[model samples]
Target: MKQSFVYILKCSDGSYYTGVTSNLSARMFKHNSGFYPDCFTFNRRPLELVFYCEFTDINLAIEKEKQIKKWSRAKKEALINDDFDELVNLAKKSFGK
Candidate 1:
């Protein structure tokens, strides 16, 4: 069975980029080589692979990628740091209903 991955890269500009791919190595190479000029990490070269999670289903990987793309930077940082408690705390609504 093939594995898919949802990955986050820390760009040179201190921003995060989220993506999904089946081949992690090739994808990293492409990003570093500017293979996709229009891609977020292209001009933001010198990207560092900060976080990644593997899934058996490509759909799941893509779904996770989409979800992470919408996450607040604090939440994403909590996840990257493996701070589940902080992640949950960050998910709470800041303002009252």
Candidate 2:
């Protein structure tokens, strides 16, 4: 089975980019090489890979990527830092529930 990955890149400008890929190494190379001028991470080069999770299903990977892309910076940081408690707390605050 082919593996998929959901990744977070910390841009040079202190912003984050979330994406999903089946070939992570190749994707990283493309991002760092300015392969896509119109891409969000194109100008935000010198990116640091802050987080990644593997999935056997591409659909799940894509779903996770979309979800992460919608997250607040604080929530994304919490996930990158492996702070699940903070993640849940931030989610609750964001939802006000």
Candidate 3:
């Protein structure tokens, strides 16, 4: 069974990019090489692989990718730092309510 992964790349510009791929290493290479010129990480080269999670289901990975894409930078940082509690706090503190 092929594994799916949702990964985060920390760009040189201090921004985060989220993506889903079956092969994490290969995707990272593609991002670094600027294979997708129109991609967010293309111009923001010199990215570091900061976080990743693997799943046996592609749907799950895609869902996670979508969820992360909507997150604020602060929440993303909390996630990257493995701060689940902080993530929950930020979610609860959302002003949109």
Clashing pairs in 3: none
What local lDDT does model 2 show for residue 71? 96
Model 3, residue 42: distance off in Å is 1.1
TM-score of 3: 0.93
- Residue 54, candidate 3: Cα error in Å is 0.4
lDDT of each: 0.93, 0.94, 0.94
lDDT of model 3, residue 21:
97
After superposition, candidate 1 runs with Cα above 4 Å error: none
Which 10 residues in a row give candidate 3 its minimum summed lDDT? 88-97
Model 2, residue pairs in steric clash? none
Tens-digit per-residue lDDT, 8-82, candidate 3: 999999999999999999999999999999999989999999999999999989999999999999999999999
- TM per candidate comes to 0.95, 0.94, 0.93
Q: Residues 1-97, candidate 1, lDDT per residue (tens digit)?
A: 7999899999999999999999999999999999999998887989999999999999888888998999999999999999999999988888777
Better of 2 and 3 by TM-score: 2
The list of candidate 3 runs beyond 4 A from truth reads: 94-97
Best by TM-score: 1
